[model samples]
Target chain A: MGRVVIDVMPKPEILDPQGKAVVGALPRLGFTGFTGVRQGKRFELEVEGEVTDEVLAEARKAAETLLSNPVIEDVVSVRAADGAAGAGA
Target chain B: MGRVVIDVMPKPEILDPQGKAVVGALPRLGFTGFTGVRQGKRFELEVEGEVTDEVLAEARKAAETLLSNPVIEDVVSVRAADGAAGAGA
Candidate 1:
């Protein structure tokens, strides 16, 4: 069966303390060369069977409703697991 | 400037309650066609200027040491933001 990968991230204007913490820790750990960082969430959904248009539509609906908070966060992309990041409907 | 994206996910055998919660809510929300769900973390590192080899290596080091917990979670990939996901040193 195919899988749909949904990437959810906070809106750019939103303050991401978790991401900022990581960025802040980088230099202390002696690892540098980064200016800023943003952290987000990714979800992989393994479909019981084939991945079809209907499946993608349902996945999108779920992403819009449950997986991500439309207010402060957005669904970056919903794509097939075996495919590219933006290869979803 | 270019960016690097690091994807961190819990091991497959690990019990992901967050993913399960989302899966359980899917059907109840009238969305179906999936079996299992996995949740992960995605980090977007925006370099101040350019994305070079040294930058990527440092990013990987950061991923291994800071971004992910090696015991329970693994670094799925460290890639250039403009490039494909697995395209990191």
Candidate 2:
């Protein structure tokens, strides 16, 4: 098996209200000296089989098709965990 | 300046209701052959100065101190953008 990780985020130009709220709440939570804190989402999947290029491609397609919203958000990256063999196979 | 990216997630044993809802909605969204979709958060910050260990440590402290919920969520990883030297300085 293999592990695939996907990071999805809104474009920088986009306004992230949730992130803004979190950032606004940070100072009260004890965080200081930071300006912006943009928030996004990450997805991790354990797939059956080896971490082949084919598997990676399929996962990308899956992400584009349903796992993420291509309109408001972008799939920033997709990576396979090292030593993921036999993980979910 | 440096760009620090932090990924936060619930531990593997934790139940991600949002992720579960997304996963349940995937098939309707046309995704197939995937069993799970776990969701987490990522924070990207543009900081002033070089990407040295000190900068990284400060960023980590910020994360642990306020940016993330250390009790319910773990700061899975932190990274610097590859070409962040002139971006935020």
Candidate 3:
């Protein structure tokens, strides 16, 4: 099966408490020199066929509507999963 | 600033309720032809300088120790953010 990857991130202007928590914890965990962090969501959708442009367009529509909240998040990427099985098939 | 992107996914053998819910809801929402959905996390970390190999190494360390639960999640990818404002600067 083909897989499409979707990435949704909080808009740059939005507050991301999860990201804040992570950035805060990094230093305490001794992972330093990080100035900031933003946490987002990634979804992998498996289809029965090849990841054609038609499939990608459908995935993009799904990404904007069901996968992410357009009010606060941006659908940063909607594309084929790289180099994976079925991606190049 | 340079940004590194880390992707974490639930191990294939693990149960993912969120992904289940999404896959279940998709057909109901009139989006079909998708067989499965797996949800994961994406994190963008901003550093003060260029994304050198050393910086990427640090990000990898952070990803393994802090960003993912090795028991349940896999760190799928960790690399410099692509073509963003600070990524190539």
Q: Specify the highest-TM-score model's number.
A: 3
- Write candidate 1's Cα lDDT for A1-89 as tens digits: 78898888888888999999988999999977788899999898989888888888889889999988888887877877775432311
B1-89: candidate 3 lDDT, tens digit per residue: 78999989888888999999999999998899999999999999999999999999999999999999989888888889867722210
Better of 1 and 2 by DockQ: 1
The Cα RMSD of model 2 versus the native structure comes to 4.8
After superposing candidate 3 on the true structure, give the runs of residues whose Cα lies further than 4 Å from its correct spot.
A85-89, B85-89
Off by over 4 Å in 1: A83-89, B83-89
> How big is the positional error of residue B44 in model 3, measured in Å on the Cα after superposition?
0.2
lDDT of 2: 0.70
lDDT of 2 by residue, A1-89 (tens): 56788777777678989778867876676665556777788787766676678767877877676666777777777778666321211
* DockQ metric, candidate 3: 0.51
- What's the true lDDT of residue A54 in model 1? 87
Give the better candidate number (1 or 3) by DockQ: 3
Q: How many angstroms is residue A63 displaced in model 1 relative to the true structure, after the best TM-score fit?
A: 0.7
**Clash numbers, per candidate:** 0, 1, 0
Computed on C-alpha atoms, the DockQ of candidate 1 is 0.44
